[model samples]
Target: MSVFVTVLSLSSLATILAALVSLADYHLNDYGVCTININGGTRTVDVNGGSSILSSLAKHKIFIPSACGGKATCGLCKVTMVDTISPVLPTEEPYLTAKEIEGGVRLACQVKVKRDLEILIPGEFLTVSQYQAKVEKITKLTYDIKKFRLRLLDPAQMEFKAGQYVQVDSKLYGAVREEVSRAYSISSAPSDRKAIELVVRLVPGGICTTFLHEHVKVGDKLTLAGPFGEFYLREGADHLIFIAGGSGLAPIRPMILDILKRKLDKKMTFFFGAVSRKDLFYVDYFRDLEARYPNFTYIPALSGAKPEDEWDGEEGLITEVVARNISDPEGKQAYLCGSPGMIDAALGTLREIGIGAEHIYYDKF
Candidate 1:
């Protein structure tokens, strides 16, 4: 019995020592540097092993556009890996295609840098730069939506297509102890160089939105990286149809303003949808703009209007209202922004009305 006890103690000590060694290797012991050969040797970054590929590249100022800040939710930081790190993770399964998986495409956020690696990234992303910004003001647009005015402290001027978006970083706050980033469309017109605006609706249980609504202050400084996404007006599109729900108007607002700012002869019709009158915002602004621009039309729709609201505008689902008003959508370009369901319904309606799938652009969150 004494011999058996001594052997058990030895085994337990060996297990503990093994665990300590692994912990040291993972977090304490410094692994030597490794090189990341990017885009077929267009650039190379030497970073220490044991960090995520996304973060390692960022240390070298190579900003890969990630809306979820390496959390694997946005799936924007995908890259074709020419070298092996590990198999595709379950967190990345939903974002990758079968071909992408077979072709060695991996989520940069999920892959750890343990050795040298080769990755392929879009050449255009090399142009993305990080910016420092300050929250100049916050305007409550409705019960749930608020407009944030961010003044660019660095890179004082940003040249982005009106409908593009930027990933805003939320620093540590209540319930969220670590920093995170989420993309928000630019609501401010491109002509406004020094400052940009974002219209955000309170997303229940959303980390970034919670930080913006609860923790962020007017004078708080934040980091933003972007001008990403490709939901912009097609050049020389003569007729445009804009449909937005909730805070989806963030991107559409700037596109409309872009047209008016250029004094372009493009015909514009904007449809804004909400549940009730109280859920609506920016009605006066769009109405005022419509009054000024002869070629622009503003249509606000309420899907669930209260009797006390005395709603006189279009009622019922926005898809139905759109089908009724727009007779021929064949040659028109449609820009949609909303929840996935809203965008899907609008797409089907537009397609039925002869709008080609390619002509309909959307930003789905």
Candidate 2:
């Protein structure tokens, strides 16, 4: 009976100690409130001082472009710190250049808010806002690619450039217990203020992509923030060259439509690359546009055409086709959106064709 009593007493004592320890730890670690001074005190926000700067700013409706959901992988949430809070983390090294580090630029997602901070945010990010949107429709563009049209609910309007992207936040669904956010370029024209379209390709085991591809449905509500990135069309160029592959066509499509709708005095030639006819999308759309617009041309190239595919388009790589078509790169600006490999190869090819590096703009995924 004494032994049983002693065990019970000890267990009760341990439980009390554990609870006290947890309470003490919470009090000790509680930073209470902290202030974030933005852009030299142009704006200030008071937040609870335990979360990341990204989340803290987000709580105040100040959205930073973070594609990896605070994982520090996307490296898009960069802000300049006026005062140093901590040393640069190992995770931020890959994203920061020497100049950026020297200028006190740090990843907002990785920087914890332990105390008051002064940071500089670009003026463009000041206009970014979060919106509650509904998945209005889903269109299958290819086997792995689908277009998601999201209609804004609260704000009902989003003013964004032709090539800017938005970050879609995913919720806990099925096996995906942790929420995530991924960036997708807007495929709709900027004039379409009520809705924005995102073209997403399945990335095997990608967290957001898998959730979007498998679990998301029409009328499903989602939280998204945006109008990020600077991959838009620039004026002053009479001739434009647009190169895209796979889902890269998202931004390019909007730029093309926007330009045509505005009736810009520009000649556009779009070179779309795919593996085969199955990979090609918007062929008829661009073909119809080409037929209607005398200044527009659509060229679809197949790199790995098969016998059964019955392909008779440009039977070569995109770069090869581009080289064969364009004889003069003078007064022309090139816009490319694709994988990093394709961007690098296209850069080399464009440079070889006498296009200056400054005349080329690309958004490499």
Q: Which regions of candidate 2 are displaced past 4 Å?
A: 1-28
Residues 65-172 of candidate 1 have per-residue lDDT tens digits of 787889898888888999666889999999999999998999889998888899999886677778899999999999889999999989887889899899898888
RMSD of 2: 7.1
Candidate 1 at 186: error in angstroms? 0.9
Q: Which candidate has the top score in TM-score?
A: 2
| C-alpha lDDT of all candidate models, in order | 0.89, 0.92
Error of 1 at 288 (Å): 1.3
Which digits, one per residue and each the tens of the lDDT, describe model 2 over residues 100-147? Answer: 999999999999898899999898888899999999999999999999
TM-score of 2: 0.90
- Displacement of the residue 294 alpha carbon in candidate 2, Å: 1.1
Model 1 misplaced stretches (Cα beyond 4 Å):
1-31
Clashing pairs in 2: none
